[model samples]
Target: MELQPLATFRVELAPVLHVGRTRWGDRRVIGIVGGSFSGPRLNGEVLPGGADWQVVHEDGSASIDTRYTLRTHDGALLYIQTQGVRHGPPEVMARLAAGEDVDPAEYYFRLFIRFETGSPDYAWLGRTLAVGTGRREPNAVVYDAFTLT
Candidate 1:
């Protein structure tokens, strides 16, 4: 299979709200305030009210689940759900949490991105399998998603 560039999106996040440890793990939620995306075929802005629900394991690895809505410039709404993992050395993760400018290559942040939309203009997204590579910025997380063909 070949991977084609689908879209690249930059997600602006609010400060993470810690939920502390539960029976499952250490839970946290990052509010999705706003963001935008631009790509060859799709361009839009991410609406508010979405969130990333995270579970931090004992080993410092985080399992990520994010659900959000994307409104295309042309007025189509797409539902986005991405499941991913982010992990690295403790020091590296600490630097990220401190909002330091560390190299993304030093850590592993990847996701399986999925989309659902009833809009005819974006129906292809509903059938594609996409993967994303992520990097943590000071106030946002950026990711480039590619579709598998």
Candidate 2:
């Protein structure tokens, strides 16, 4: 199967709420303030209120889990969920944590994305399986998504 370009999205985030260390790991929650997305077939704005519930492991790898809403330009509401991981060399990860604008290629951040919607115009998304390569900016996360076809 070939990977088809799906969309490129930038998710704006608020400051991270560190929940401290737990048995699982260091948990943190970052509010999804706002953002936008565009592609050949989909274009929309990300609604506020969603969040990323993340867990940083002892080895510095982070488990990325996020849920959010997307409003299409045509007025369809869609639910979006992504699960992924982000990791890299210790020094690079440290720089990223320090809020530096390091190149995305320096780290490994990837995601498995899922979409759900009841609108007939976007019904095709329900059956599509997508994957994304992500980058953590100072206050946002950007990713280019691809669907398996």
Candidate 3:
């Protein structure tokens, strides 16, 4: 299958709430404050109140679990969920955790994206499968999403 450019998302985040180590792993909840997304097919602002519930495993790989809402320019509301992983060498991960501006190539961050909506105009999204590559900034996470065709 080929990949087609879908959209670029820049999600703003609040400070992480450390939940300590649970039976699963080191848990952290990051508040999704606000953000924006744009592309050929979709453009909108990310609504607040969503969050990422992250679990960092023993091997230092993080399980990316996020759910959020998107309001398209024309007024369609879409539900978005993403699952993936982010991992790298010790030093690289450390740099990222320290909020350094390291190159994305220094680590691996990828996601599988899904969308759901009741709006007829955006119903196509319900059947669309997407993937994304991510980068962590000091206060935001940015990613470019591509739809699988």
Give the Cα error of residue 4 in candidate 1, in Å. Answer: 0.3
Tens-digit lDDT track of model 2 for 1-149:
99999889999999999999999899999999999999977899999989999999999999999999999999999999999999999999999999999999899999999999999999999999999999999999999999999
- Tens digits of per-residue lDDT, candidate 1, 12-99, equal 9999999999987999999998999988778989898799999999998999999999999899999999999999999999999899
What is the alpha-carbon lDDT for the whole of candidate 2? Answer: 0.96
Per-residue lDDT tens digits for candidate 3, residues 62-103, read: 999999999999999999999999999999999989988989
Poorest stretch of ten by lDDT in candidate 3:
93-102
Runs off by more than 4 Å, candidate 1: none
Model 1 error, position 18 (Å):
0.6
Give the per-residue Cα lDDT of candidate 3 at 15. Answer: 94
- Tell me the spans in candidate 2 whose CA falls farther than 4 Å from its real position: none
- Cα lDDT of candidate 3 equals 0.96
lDDT of each: 0.93, 0.96, 0.96
